[model samples]
Target chain A: MTDRYKYMEDLLNRFFSGETSNEEERELYRFFAGEDIPAHLRRYKPVFSYFESGLEKELNLLTGEPAEAAEPFRRAMPKRRIRIAAGMAALALILSVAALLFLRKANAFDPYEGSYIVRSGVRITDTSLIRPEIEATIQKALQQEERANRLLLSLSASNPETRIEQIQRRINRQNEEIINRFPNEMKESIRRIIENK
Target chain B: MKTRHLIAAAILLITGSLSANLPAQETLKALVKKCESMDNVNTSVVRNRNKQTKKLEKEIISLNFSNNQALVNEFIAAFEKDKLMADKEIEGKNNGKKTLFYRFGDTSYSFSQLNEGSASVSVIQKDEYEYEE
Candidate 1:
């Protein structure tokens, strides 16, 4: 045992000087793991145990075992999920607001939204009260335009002789209709009277 | 292909500007807007609805002003200027009252002096005339 202690003291000096081999350092760790260490070596036992623990952690990493390095990443997973969920919720809110505005614009489009009327110097914009007047005004304007169209058509028609012939034909057709309304015996007499005229 | 696209775009822009600068319609609209603030004027705008679907269709603007020769002349001048751009024009006189009608594209305008102490100008859809027929 005195020889073993002397050898371990030599290895400790080599380790502190950074010149100890891997096998010598491992032997020193094994020696510190035994409870039979002498009272004189107790203070150095703690330093060897620390190195043993550090070597075990490196072996765990090489052997694909669970490691303390992954603990922080595992803890951050839930936070990432929460951030993504919050971003989606914000996007949904903005989309809904945009949709609402578009619907309002579509629903509010009206051609006659600002229609109004004036009566005796009073400007009235009440749609319900002026509805009839609006209709009447439109009707009057349409009628006036129709009259102008008819007058133009008449003035642009063929010569007076053609117009007179057309009028004569219309009168004859009217007479024929009137005669047809009479009885069969009186129809012939009515037609003959019309022909004589 | 890019030069062809550029030429097409230039043509489209020129035609768009030319159509937008139709002076007659612009002048009439400006006149109507100005008359809206006048005390002696009554204006009415009516949008026609489809008989079957109830969908809003064409619109008509009617303005009635107290008989003023100056206003009548202004409208006539606009009508005459529009006549140069119109597809059709008609002028008629009945019982000393003169009426003028002009059609541009799908829009028609009429200016009439009634027997009453009122003169009216109407901007209506051209289809309204066909509807009467």
Candidate 2:
């Protein structure tokens, strides 16, 4: 037990324990590659001496022969992680701003951005509901109106004499109402009609 | 490939969810055109039912809009003068509803100004008269 503890203690004292990084692990390899060991362990003399010759390798910290130099990935990884995190954060901020702008424009609060104001009390009609696409709606409404008028015309043609008499009576009543409704200057149209009749 | 398809489906779902609400929103040009085509009085239909009979009551209504400030003020002046004339003619006879003459396409429409910007006019005939029902 004492021998095991002593061996572990010496290994830890030279940074060959669990705490050894890539650099320190390689240092341990170099330190062990020797012929001369300590007096207590003279049977492993060649192993210790081989490591001592390579002690010059420990001094060459900048050169790359094996684990003599620092790891390239370890040196560069932190900066790359920081740069990627920064890019993600910037992207998130941009997306948030775009979302805010889209919400404001969508709510019809801005005139510069496309938005429609609705009539306050009017119940929305299906025909006039498509405010953004008014052309299509107007065309559809005009077609429907034309169809209704054509139906009316067909009905009038079917009962020509009675329909004409009824129309004449409605017109005469409307003319009387107009003549009673207006003043001298406003009644000129009715005067011309009466004279022509 | 399955993961890619799932991601694409999720994107489509999100966009479709956002776009579904588009129909409820209105545009600016439609508002301006409607404002332009407004009149001083328009008919509104009122439907009432008691037991087996459904009745329609036609009430004259006045129209006022923010854009027609000048016309509204003119109507107010005309209303005040008519009220003064009515007070002189009927001295003690006062009815809650009063009629003043309004013109529409060479026709006289009986109406009364409700306020500075609003007027009341007879709009629609009864859909079914109560006596007939």
- Please list the C-alpha lDDT of all candidates, in the order they appear: 0.70, 0.40
Candidate that would win on TM-score = 1
Q: Cα deviation in Å at residue A105, candidate 2? A: 5.6
The worst-scoring run of ten residues by lDDT in candidate 2 chain A lies at: A109-118
Query: For residues A33-127, what per-residue lDDT tens digits would candidate 2 score against the true structure?
Result: 54333446454445445555456566564465655345667867988999999999999999999999998865633211121122454433332
CA-RMSD of model 1: 19.2
> Cα lDDT for residue A38, model 1?
85
Stretches of candidate 1 exceeding 4 Å from the true structure = A1-114, A120-122, A152-197, B1-24, B51-54, B94-96, B115-117, B126-133
Question: Cα deviation in Å at residue A82, candidate 1?
Answer: 36
Error of 2 at B74 (Å): 5.6
Best by lDDT: 1
TM-score result, candidate 1: 0.44
| Model 2 backbone overlap count | 20
For model 2, what TM-score is found for chain B? 0.27
Per-model TM-score, in order, reads 0.44, 0.26
